[model samples]
Target: MSQLPKRIIKESQRLISDPVPGITAVPHEDNLRYFQVTIQGPKESPYQDGLFKLELYLPDDYPMVAPKVRFLTKIYHPNIDRLGRICLDVLKKNWSPALQIRTILLSIQALLSAPNPDDPLSNEVAEHWKRDEQDAIATAKEYTKLYATEQ
Candidate 1:
């Protein structure tokens, strides 16, 4: 692998030293561009009390192109598919070079807090959410309890 960019080095350092309140990102020893991340579910959300794991990877042309991010832990959200692909605009069309790893992860955390069924990655889940929001939230909570619990 080529030498890591100075920007990545600095971002990794800050992530470890002055981490986000409910998020933690640690790079792999062999590959600095790959990170193992964990996010605490936001309060009052269906996913509350859960801890979701995710993987984030910065490509060679990062900052110019958005970093690749996907949930590793199972979650029941309309905007997140069964394969864990998230339907967040910032990760796609709205991405900007100014966005950092921390900002991207924070956006994902916020997604968990406010799921958008209207623009969804998982159609089935979106339909479920649209049909009965309360039941969908209950299902989300059930999924969180079953999958996102600490081990």
Candidate 2:
């Protein structure tokens, strides 16, 4: 059988040993390339105090092509779609081989702090954020309280 790639192994080890604050990524035993992730919502944001779940998968090409990641927990952000897909540059056109799992996770966390209404995946959510930001934030906070509470 082929062995796990050196980069993947190294990254997995680093993730466990030197993890980013508010983010935890652990590879599954059955599939080393697949990871179960949990991101603590950033302070002062609508998602604060909530634990957001996500899934990350490193493709065969890996560093050559960015990892596939998506939110699993319910989040009311303009950049994240109803299906949990994110509209982030690094995850899309701006990705580079030099980027890493840690960086991407950090980016996702930052996105929580700053939701861009202009570039949105969910048009409805974007409209809400644009038309009435305060109301949208209130709604997001309510959702975080209702759906993202620790289980």
Candidate 3:
């Protein structure tokens, strides 16, 4: 068995044992290294009703490197590019071995609540965010309502 599977199994157990509000994860039965995660938007954000799905892939070097995460659902935000790549600090330079899946998901939820325009992955979204916070928030709400709502 691959070491990645073992790590993911342990992480999933930890997530289940000590659940994080607004976030949950489960590995695919066919592929242990790939996980499906759901993250509820933070309470105070315009994305409050949003339920975002994420695809996580554990690299061979897990603890030493951050897992690759992508938004499976379309998300229009300053920190997430058009391609759905997230630009979170912890997922990059700030990553540490101590970080776990639960913490990362929580951080993503927090990121939605408070986006950093200065370091944005989507330039247009960032410009809107910097120029007008209210309009940006409104647009985010519109996107959440249009794309993120559950059928």
Candidate 4:
């Protein structure tokens, strides 16, 4: 058996032991470095009841380097671009060694609740959110119903 990195193995164990509410991370059976995550939308948010999938890749130099994360599910949000890239400070410049997978997923869930218009990945969505909060929220709800809802 290929020996996995200590950090990755420990992180995986922690995720399994103390899972974040509404979020699950399962490592690929073939590759321990890659993980699949599913995060449920926060209650009462426009994305409520939605289940979003994401793929996470932990580099060999983890803790020093942040994991690569991308949404596998299509989502309409100001901070999420068309390609599913997220614009969150914590994922980038603000990342700290103290942060873990559960914390990252929780931050993402919070992002769905309160989008950051100041720094938006989707300009049109940001503009809509800035100009008309109600309309933007309504549209988000519609998207949740249409694209995010399980068939």
User: Which candidate should be chosen as best, given TM-score against the real structure?
Assistant: 1
Off by over 4 Å in 1: none
**lDDT leader:** 1
RMSD of 1: 0.6
Runs off by more than 4 Å, candidate 3: 1-6
Which residue pairs come into collision in candidate 1?
Answer: none
lDDT of 3 by residue, 21-101 (tens): 788888788887778999998888988989999998777888789988999888879999978899998999999988987
Query: Model 4 over residues 1-151: C-alpha lDDT tens digits?
Result: 5688787789899999988889999999988889999989899899999888899888777778778888888888999988889998889999997888778888989999889888999999999999999999999888888878899
RMSD of each: 0.6, 0.9, 1.4, 1.4
Worst 10 residues of 4 by lDDT: 1-10
Itemize residue pairs with steric clashes in candidate 3. none
Cα lDDT tens digits, model 1, 3-107, are 899999999999999999999999999899999999999999999999999999999999899999999999999999998999999999999999999999999
Q: Which of candidates 3 and 4 is the stronger one according to TM-score?
A: 4
Query: Which portions of model 4 show Cα errors greater than 4 Å?
Result: none
Query: Which of the two, 3 or 4, has more lDDT?
Result: 4
Specify the poorest-scoring 10-residue window by lDDT in model 3. Answer: 1-10
10 residues in a row with least lDDT, candidate 2: 1-10
Clashes of each: 0, 0, 0, 0
